[model samples]
Target: MAAEGKINPMHQFTINQIGPKLEIAGYNISFTNSALWMVLALVVIWLFMLGGMKRELVPGRWQMAVEGVTGFIRNMIDTNIGPEGRRYTPYLFSLFTFILISNLLGMLPLAIVPGFHAFTTTSHFSITGLLALMSFAIVLVVGFWRHGFHFFALFLPKGTPAFMVPVIIPIEIISFLVRPFSLLLRLFVAMISGHILMEVFSSFIVNGLGSSSAIGFGVSLLSFVFIVGIGALEILVCALQAYVFALLTSLYLNDAINLH
Candidate 1:
């Protein structure tokens, strides 16, 4: 909760139950605001894709927009993972679109409505961690299924001294294990930091506006200007983070597919 005459930016990220509490034996499976946003994101993606599903002879704006994004991801995979990557396009497309929409949705100015606010699901570690885990799992499955024990060679690199084998192997193993952690942390940190910065400035605006002095008014106006700038930057960050996450996922898939 925010203090009187102050805004609590973190309050926006709070997960509240949307319906009656639900539990299964010893575990609570109640729906939350985070889950609500995830569902909404999926719905938006579906509707967006639906627009381009016509496969018309001549594409309209909707079809063209969808094709453009789809082509971008396809090209990215082709560059990073080559021909074999084509087989993974559907999953990658879904992953990229989902993250992109979810990040953008968090920036929505829905807080104008009483008792309602936009939530950034990706800002949470659990959500990003789950995504990272899913991507890593796919990589593991593809690597082991295709190459068997040869997949272990991913850590060995091309050329290394026999004496350094012990040192290099441990280092490589650790690095390999860090992939999902890095993937999740990167998205989570980028999102949470931007929101926190915006929230801090927002509080300043509120505080300044409540004051009667000229300096306070000036501060409020300045803070609003900064918020606008930060808001634009946040929009860029949202897209960039999605791209980075998708690119990294594709690169990791390449390692599994090509073992390089």
Candidate 2:
């Protein structure tokens, strides 16, 4: 049995089986919360788009909200990537919506306790890794689509001397491979850290107040107030992280498309 006062927020990262397990080579194939959240993110994006499409001109509250979000992403892409990169708007928009929704949804007290008790997909490295891989794939595809074989020349900066090519080229290649790692780390760390802090503080308040009479109650009250403030900050973080992720993705695409 679990301890009465102990909290286990990290349990959110567990993978619960949904069906008969299948062995693929030597790997265990099973359904998990990570997969569930990925699907939920996609569904949320699809529904938002569909709602916006349904009310193209005579917009309702939902439509207006959807348009405002799309417009913000449009401006972000335009500013960072320019008109030539407008073709990638759908992808950028999708990425932003999916992440934003996932982050916010994780904050909500849902049937499956978002971001807690085997319910958090965003905390899993595999999910973040796949997302980073997708972003890299987009960069590569767009680069090849725009510049063909000439894109390889981007590794060699124009001012580089022949003697320095040996040194700089390998460095550039490593940097290119590390792009996905950076993206994965940024998103994963931000999301996981925020939720973990919130959980820890909340558990503190619950346990602290429950343990004593007056002083504990006062301390718990203070902790609750602090948690509320942190909640607001987390909202900002959720939106900012989503925006930063999409913005950096756009910048990366721009680099690939307009490679030197």
Segments of candidate 1 deviating more than 4 angstroms: none
Please list all clashing residue pairs in model 1, or write none if there are none.
none
Highest lDDT: which candidate? 1
List clash counts for every candidate, in order. Answer: 0, 1
Give Cα-based local distance difference scores for all models.
Answer: 0.93, 0.80
TM-score of 1: 0.98
Candidate 2, residues 77-179, lDDT tens digits: the string is: 7888888888888888888887888887777655244434425555667777887899999899888888899989778988999999999999998998999
lDDT of 1 by residue, 49-104 (tens): 99998999999999999999999999999999998899999989998999999999
Q: Please give the distance, in angstroms, between residue 194's alpha carbon in candidate 2 and its true position after superposition.
A: 1.1
- Per-residue lDDT, model 2, residue 81, is 82
User: Residue 76 of model 1: what lDDT?
Assistant: 97
